[model samples]
Target: MSSSASDVAPRRPLLAGRGLLWEAVILAVGVGLFFLFPYDLGFLSRILIMIVFVLSLDLVLGYAGVATLGQAAMYGTGAYAAGLIAIHVTASPLLGLAAGAVAGAGIAFVSGLVLMRAHGLTLLMLSIAVAQVLQEVANKARPLTGGADGLRGIRMDPILGLWEFDFIGRAGYWYVLTVLILVLLFLKVVVNSPLGLSARGIQESPERMRAIGTPVYWRLVWIYTIAGGIAGVAGALAAQVTALVSLEVFNFDHSAEALIMLVLGGAGRLYGAVVGVAIFMLVEHVAAAVDPFNWLFLIGALVLAVVFFVPAGLLGLPKALTGLVRR
Candidate 1:
């Protein structure tokens, strides 16, 4: 069951015409929505942040074939790092984000050293353990983390000394949108790079990749670290926008829901993350508004429908339908 590079890598270069067209479409849609929902910036920002978070997951569980339920480890660490820095030292959002990224990458590198060695159930369990440990530490360190009550007083300075974080969130919306675009563009490059190709090859078969002189172990760690940094950025964005960090950021539900979003969108296709998050969040928002207590039922039904009807995920429906047509 060997998969070729052509099979795993994107068909077209990221800078190709088609790729640029896709990027343009995303930009247009984002800007259009910005105008359409002038008042729901908070919600929009949440979706965008989740898009980034899930995008990071795609790089690991999707591209690298590393399936684990502990991504919240990096995410929670990033949020706390950003919040702590904002409270104790600097209020510069950019600085806080950098601190968050560094903290996430730091944790990922250390943990990946060991977790990447384990596979199957072992890997999954170890990943969960890593996150649980961090969560417990955060919970106990009440003096610094504010414990279960959550970390507060995360005031942020204006963006680059120009835009103020207005009460209505107009400035915050644009800030998040800009960062999201940058993340998408950066991942586009990563997905097309030599490292990216090696990661995919490793995913198909680590033993084969190792025989071919591909540093399989290091590749996994590298990609996982990169994913951690991105996840951290997402957490930082959440902390900065809300001006608070909470224990729930590390909840197992966060990682589980993110994995579900990846499944619904179609893993490995980077843009699929965006499509999945947008659809899932919109459904949840509407469902919760209509029936707060029963929203989970709607969400569960939607998940079941997607799983049974679109096994390849909603993003793959077009190609799946085309195959059936030809048959």
Candidate 2:
């Protein structure tokens, strides 16, 4: 191997050595904490769903180098699709979930084409516009989506024909957790695949990748669509848990929150998304409990601290500490 290749190869093992271990640790802690808390399982379920949502953002924003603020559009689409399908078509949770994924992928495929053309602030603005349009559509399509009233009467069958979701939300918590793990594993595979490498290459420099004969635009389109599908799954999860979908599904705050989670945990790392959600939700809960209005102040300060001190994100801090310790 070339000297540079040899140098790079050694570094690969260090990155690999603890990623899985760290994931296991986090997952175990999440499960343990869920059981330990006297809190409602429904709340835990929401956090789990958010993890999937954040991870979806990580795929596009972190891996594919797509900076978008319109993720909620796809999320809301999947949610509504799942909710509508359950209410109007089939109550089977599986089928409703599929519908949501299809809806998300369909929208992403179309939007990615238009979004791929722009970059930087222009791209961000277009994404926001797309989300806003969807939110407006959801509002105007009152009869179908229930308008401001929201979609209700969604009844889902017991998951996998075994576990029934109840008001206590035990089944929902476990169900969402299982789904999150599966999605994370699937994403890990995708990111480590050839396609993911190309995405990284595209992110670093589309011009260079194109010169090397990579079909940059198409790659982006596919990646964006896949990310959308995942986000759709997250929406489906949320819809199933809440059994309600509304114009709020398309809310820009949803996208903004997901972005914050992605950044808080650290972009480029999948598990960072999960950690970000955990911390964000924890802080949110604590803050709201202490003072509803002042919670924002605490969160704002926390975010600023992370940005200034841990720019790589919370996930990066552990590695940084470990490196320092070793040195």
- Encode model 1's per-residue lDDT on 57-153: one tens digit a residue: 9999888989989999999999999999999999999999999899988899999999999999999889989988999999999999999999988
lDDT of each: 0.90, 0.88
**What does candidate 2's lDDT look like per residue over 123-217, in tens digits?**
99999888899889998999899889998888999998998988878888888888888888788878998898898888899999999998888
Q: Which regions of candidate 2 deviate over 4 angstroms? A: 1-19, 322-327
For model 1, the run of ten residues with the poorest summed lDDT = 1-10
Best-matching candidate per lDDT = 1
RMSD of each: 4.2, 3.3
Cα deviation in Å at residue 193, candidate 2?
0.2
TM-score, candidate number 1: 0.93
TM-score for all models, in order of appearance: 0.93, 0.92
Q: lDDT value for candidate 1?
A: 0.90
Error at 68, model 2, angstroms: 0.7
